[model samples]
Target: MEQPVHHFSELFEQLGLASDAEAIEAFIQRHAPLPESVALHEASFWSPSQAELLRNALEDDADWAEVVDHLDASLRKP
Candidate 1:
């Protein structure tokens, strides 16, 4: 069976960011429209540990990967 996916709120909480709906939206608004050359894990706004968590989740396809991908997509919008 596939693992259940989580919400962006949970992903934000895991990243040690504010996890409320408003905060999540604010975060996306602030950092989104990522450059094509920069991957989510390579974004300059993340702390080292936060970046590592995202990198690992994507690399390992962890339970968090789905939500992480959602975040990645959100950031890519122009």
Candidate 2:
């Protein structure tokens, strides 16, 4: 089964915010830099190592908006 989709609000909450899209965006950008070499649609490219690195970064930094915008754009890419 596929993982359920979450609204930006939910993501914000998960990231420890009360409720704020802008804030969530800020948090993600500060912490999660999109992997430059990974193809967004390549499922296999999102390996465990990549995930761990993302997780580690998120754990450390929690403030940045560009990351959220990048993620949104990447997801919309064809």
Candidate number of the best TM-score: 1
Give each model's whole-structure lDDT.
0.94, 0.48
How high a TM-score does candidate 2 get? 0.31
The C-alpha stretches of model 1 lying farther than 4 A from their native spots are none
Which digits, one per residue and each the tens of the lDDT, describe model 1 over residues 1-78?
969868889999999999999999899999989998998999999999999999999999899998999999999997
How do the predictions measure up, each by TM-score?
0.93, 0.31
Task: Give the residue spans of candidate 2 off by over 4 A.
Answer: 1-5, 34-78
lDDT of 1: 0.94
In the order shown, the candidates' Cα RMSDs to the true structure are 1.1, 10.6
Model 1: weakest 10-residue lDDT segment is 2-11
What would the per-residue lDDT of candidate 2 be over residues 1-78, giving only the tens digit for each residue? 643554657544544454576775564455444455654323343456544443554455444233544454644444
